[model samples]
Target: MSKVVLITGASSGIGKSIAHYLIEKGYIVYGTSRNPREKVVNGINFVALDVTKTETIQQAVKEIAEKEGKIDFLINNAGMGITGPIEETPDDEIKRIFDTNYFGVIKVIKAVLPIMRKNNGGFIINITSIAGYMGLPFRGIYSATKGALELTTEAFRMELKDFNIKMTNIAPGDFATNIAAGRYHSPIIKNSPYEKKYKSTLDLMDKHVDKGKDPLIMAEKVYAVMQEKNPTIHYKVGEFIQKFSIALKHILPDKVYEKMLMKHYKL
Candidate 1:
């Protein structure tokens, strides 16, 4: 029997690409979007889901459970981007970022865990970012959200092993996607003293994203994890430089790593 897989934020970008890839691999794929009115993509079922809303999450999981009987994989890919000086970022903006990136992920995982437990075992891939490993100059909150998620995944890995449920944090460096368009920016950034620097940094960030690695490569990584009988606790998808930078951060001295980041981002 084909595995039943559900991926959030599948309307476009990495999630959408993953959904397509999984379908090609013969997994039954269900992709979620906040707008039910969005046109459905061929070969993928789109479910209405707003990760910020608990009711919608429960309903989406229930709807899938009713039809599929069991969920074999859950991809927590629904997230939004926020940018601005951390000092100038509005409280609401910070909350919104965490809501979609951190809390939203927790909600979906909670809703799906019981189903996975009932099925004996299942795999969960949480879509995180390389920024989660360290704080960036202007995107501190976004980093914080992903950092919180990575730590939470670590805890989940230990707690869920007894039930045979596999959880992995899939951190991608940068990918060509529509995330730039949907990214949130604090209004205060316009008036802040650091506006010029913020704008320049934001442009630099976008430049790298524009040249980001292929989403198909990320999909392949996801598929590889799916094929694993026992997957690793973490997997990264991105260009060699980005992957190497992550390793370098771990072993390098704090000042050295900080200088490297500062030089790279021109901060």
Candidate 2:
């Protein structure tokens, strides 16, 4: 029997790539996008559902359950990127980021847990970023949301281990995705009294994000995780250099890592 998988934010980038690969792997994929009018990608089915809407969540679940009978995997991949100095970033932008990145995943997980538990087990892959591991200058807000997701993923993995729920977080280095397009956000300095405190650092981050890895590789990581019987709590993907940097960051003193980030980013 083929495993049934549903991926949110499935219209493009990593989610879309994973959908293509999984269908090739024989999983029955039901890909969701905020809009229903996506061009048909051979091998996967697309559905309309916005992660931000609870009714949309219920509707997708009801429809999928009717057709597939059970869902074996749920990829909470619907998220956006917002890069700007915390001080100058708009209050509204901060809320939008969290709503999509953090709460959106939570809503989907809550809806799927019961169905997964009934079947004895299922996998939950949360697409996080390396920023989840370290704080980059202007990426502070984005990092914070992913950091929160990292901890949440861990808790789910441990708490649901006995229930056979497998939760995993995939943290990729800067990827060549349109997430940068979504980076049009106000700097935290907008409302801050200390706007001058971090202007240069914020600008530094915006520039570095331009130099990210190809997003196609990120899709491969998602497909590989699907083949694992028991994936790790956190999997790092991307170029060898970024992987090395993460390893170095893990082993070094906080100040050393901070200095490297500052210098490399020209913060």
Candidate 3:
């Protein structure tokens, strides 16, 4: 039987690309959205799931399991973006993003674990961000959420080992996607201390996404990782500079790295 793959947030962007790619490769793909207009799209079996809602997450997983009899792979790709100066960002907004990007992922994993364990084994791949490796100026909240998820996956991998389940994190750099349109932007407050610099940084971030790599690159990378028998704990997919920044942080002095980032963001 072809492997069954479940991908959340598949209505658009990177998740959609991954769903299409895997379907072409002969995987039985179930792609989800909070609300899907159609039950299936271009070979992807669409399911309704809201990452922030535990009920929706459980229902989606149960629906897929009943139909397929087993879920061989789960790509936790459901996440939202937030961009703003940390001090200015609303407390409610911060909590909302964490609920979607961090806690939501944990809920989905919890819902899927039983089927994977009963089926003998499975793979869970988390879609994180390269930004997660380090905090960026205006994008701090988004970075923190992904960072938390990244760390959680490290611990999660070990705990799942005894059950023969494999888990890993794949952090991708900016990809050309509709993420910018969907992300929450803490309004650019007039005359606030961070106004000018925050505006500039936000513009630069949009440019990076506009020129970022094709989502298919991430799709291909996901496919490659799935073929691995002994997958590593973390994998990054992005431009050399983005991936290199993570390495630079590890080796550079704290102030030096901070300076480099400040210089890059023109803060």
Candidate 4:
């Protein structure tokens, strides 16, 4: 029988691509989006959802579980990016980021756990980022969310192993997606003590996103991991930089790496 997959943040970028890829492989994909632009792209099904909304998360799970009988895979692919220095980032904005990127997935995972545990097995693909493995200068808060995800992934992998539930993290290094979709909404950091530092960082972040790898490629890797019988806890998807950055994370000293990050961001 084909696996039943539910993906959050399915409106665009990597989430949208994963939905398409999985559906093509004959998996029943329930794609979630808050303001979904276009629904029903060939092999996919769309469910309107806001990841930050408890009511939406609960409702989406019920709809899928009732219809599909069980959920074989859950991709917590919905996330947002927040840049600028911590001092410049307002408390409200930081809370907002954590609500969407961190707590949002937590809600989805909690809602889906019983279904997967009842079935005794399934896979969870959490779409983290290169920022997950190593910190970036301007993306202070965005990196925090990814780091939280990476740690949570490890905890889930260990905690859920006996139940046959797999938690795999997809850490993509600069995949081309709508990661910067609503950057203009980012609040001004004028009150921030580190305004200058954050401005430079935001500038670099905006400049580079257009040149990243296609998100469809990242989606394909996500597909491969979902199909694995015994998947590793983490896969660094896209480009050699993933492998290199992870390696540097191990081989290089802390200060050395920080220096490199500064140089790379031209900070």
lDDT of 1: 0.90
Please report the TM-score between candidate 2 and the true structure: 0.89
In angstroms, the error of model 4 at 170 is 0.6
**Candidate 4 lDDT by residue in tens digits, 109-216:** 999999999999888889888787777776768888999998998987899978999888888877677777764235555756666766676666766677888888
Candidate with maximal TM-score: 3
Model 3 agreement with the true structure over 1-267: per-residue lDDT tens digits = 999999999989999999999999999999989889999899999999998999999999999999889999999999999999899999999999999999999999999999999999999999999999998998989999999999999999989999999999999999999999999999999999989999999999999999989999999999999999999999999999999999999999999999999999888
Q: What is the full ranking by TM-score, best candidate first?
A: 3, 1, 4, 2
Off by over 4 Å in 2: 38-41, 187-211
Clashes of 4: 1
How do the residues 75-193 of candidate 1 rate in per-residue lDDT, one tens digit apiece?
Answer: 99999999988878889889989999999999999999999999899999999998898988998999999989999999999999988999999999999998988999765445679
Best by lDDT: 3
Structural similarity to truth (TM-score) of each candidate: 0.96, 0.89, 0.99, 0.92
What is the Cα-based lDDT of residue 132 in candidate 3? 95
* Local lDDT at 220 for model 4: 83
Sort the predicted structures by lDDT, highest score first.
3, 1, 4, 2
Clash totals, every prediction: 0, 12, 0, 1
Instruction: Give Cα distance to truth, residue 138, candidate 4, Å.
Output: 1.6
Q: Worst ten-residue run, lDDT, model 4?
A: 182-191
